[model samples]
Target: MKFSSIIYVLLVFSFLTMTALSIYYYLQIQQDKVKISQAVSSGTPLPDYHFALIGEELDHDYWRLVGKGAKQNETEYDVFVEYEGPERSNPEEQLKLLDKAIKKKVDGIIVQALNDEFTPLIDLAVGKGIPVITIDTDSPDSLRSAYIGTDNYAAGQLAGKALIEDTGGEAVVGIVTGRFNNTHHSLRVEGFRDVIEQEAGIDIVAIEESNIDRIGAEEKAHNMLTEHKEITALYGTSALDGTGISEAAESLDRQDLYVITFDTLEENLRLLEKGKVDALVEQQPWKMGHQSVKIMTDLINEKQVKKIHHTNSSIVRKQNLPYRQDLRGGRQ
Candidate 1:
């Protein structure tokens, strides 16, 4: 063959080879892009999952709000929320609930721990590849993923500020708490004491524990009031105790005493309306329950969740009582 013709044939062969390779590479890239788009659109790579919550109690309005939030999230995310706890707040019951959830192979667990008894159970859940998150009350020593609840310290501070304002910064205060060891009540008492100590003319005359029970709170409040006749104010760290304190005050006809408590329970709201409890610090139990499930879902899906979520509390008095009817259930 002539040299020029042979060179032209070689050049054509090279051009065809290069064009074929380019087309193959472009098609491969397009295929990869499609796969990624499908994965993103359908969340195909996400794990199938559900979560369970072992709340402190089921019959209480506070826990009901939490369960409502969990159910709302469950519906939104197309996941199951298995909620079960004791009729009353019992650490042993909570542990049994934890065991049941683990046996069911839930994707994750959310706990409203009654006490430190659930620590080992929480650790066991984590060891078995299940993530556990604490809400409302936490077990700090456990291997839980995170805590989602109000800053109890700050809530107490708000309570103290309210008390100070109501009493014009001068009064002997009596404190009613549910449990001495419960983290929420303990932090609240600490914060309240710290703030009250900072202010002049404010003194904590007595601190009483009601075990978060109404009758116990009532008895404790009566004793405190009878013993400390100079007490000018009362503060309760739990919803039940708050109502009990109010009842005790009403029974004594001590209309001059200022009462401040926590949560928006019906009885407490009624007392607020009657000017029995001057102010109540309200926590977002619904938000706690909802966000807890969300965090658990994220953990199960291998997605990121905030290490800590703090829900703020607000002071509810008669002035703002009407607007929060849904939250207070028209208790006032």
Candidate 2:
């Protein structure tokens, strides 16, 4: 009996020793990761933290605003935000950059999760102990740290409400959205549909996808107008959709057709000023960018942060254009 008790005590001590060693090594590994993140490069000290901001496209004006917003606080926060994306809106290319960012072991990642396929990469990043924040578009099913952008459904609802109020609830509606698979675009379309379905006078004549470019949007919008002559009001659920719709409307001699579009890009704002677009469902891409860096900084500092942060969304019209502040810097 005495021998058995002694053996049991010895085994317990050994187990505790192993546990302590494991914890020590784990802590040392974590410290090493921090050191790696802070390493000097080319004899210049690195920022306190390094973050990557990947968006849908590099050349897009709306995305440029997002990048501007993301880099707004680099100096203030003593952090560096590396912003890059594909020249065009390509999910595969975007995800490839995301995977590369993960492999590079960035301190944090802020990205636009284009579709459901982004889930695995986001989860992979989290699994590797790197934090991720979804910007503009979100992967709700993934273990993302937070999402910062418009409440897509609510923004769509706003568009529908604007259309109802502006057109006296008697619009023959047609939609040209960014993409069918993009969660935000789908939510926007769904919200618009739900609202339109409730109104008896409004009937949706046709719906199309823009593929998120001016040319595609123009083609889709032109085709919709030609095929569905009854389409009195056109809603474009992407940034360039409005511009395309405007050009399409003018080309078809349908300038009087009510047009609504997403975002307040320079082109959209120009169209709005000229009365080409009836209303703009404006999203704060700059704000989305700005808040992401702030949130990521907080996250890196071990601060508790909100899981979801919506920037802002509003309807801009010709009447209110004069009263609106200069969005040149997207300061608001």
What overall lDDT goes with each candidate model?
Answer: 0.84, 0.89
lDDT of 2 by residue, 1-332 (tens): 69999999999999999897567556644765666566653355667888989999999888888898878888889887889899999999888778877877889999999898999999999999899999999899999999999999999999999999999999899999999998999999999999989999999989899999899999999999999998899999997898889999999999679999998877788888899999999889988999999999898889999999987799999888778867545665
Task: Estimate candidate 2's alpha-carbon lDDT, on a 0 to 1 scale.
Answer: 0.89
- Per-model TM-score on C-alpha atoms: 0.82, 0.86
Quality of model 1 by C-alpha lDDT: 0.84
RMSD of 1: 21.0
Q: How many steric overlaps are in each model, in order?
A: 0, 2
State how far residue 107 of model 2 sits from its true place (Å). 0.5
lDDT of 1 at 116: 77
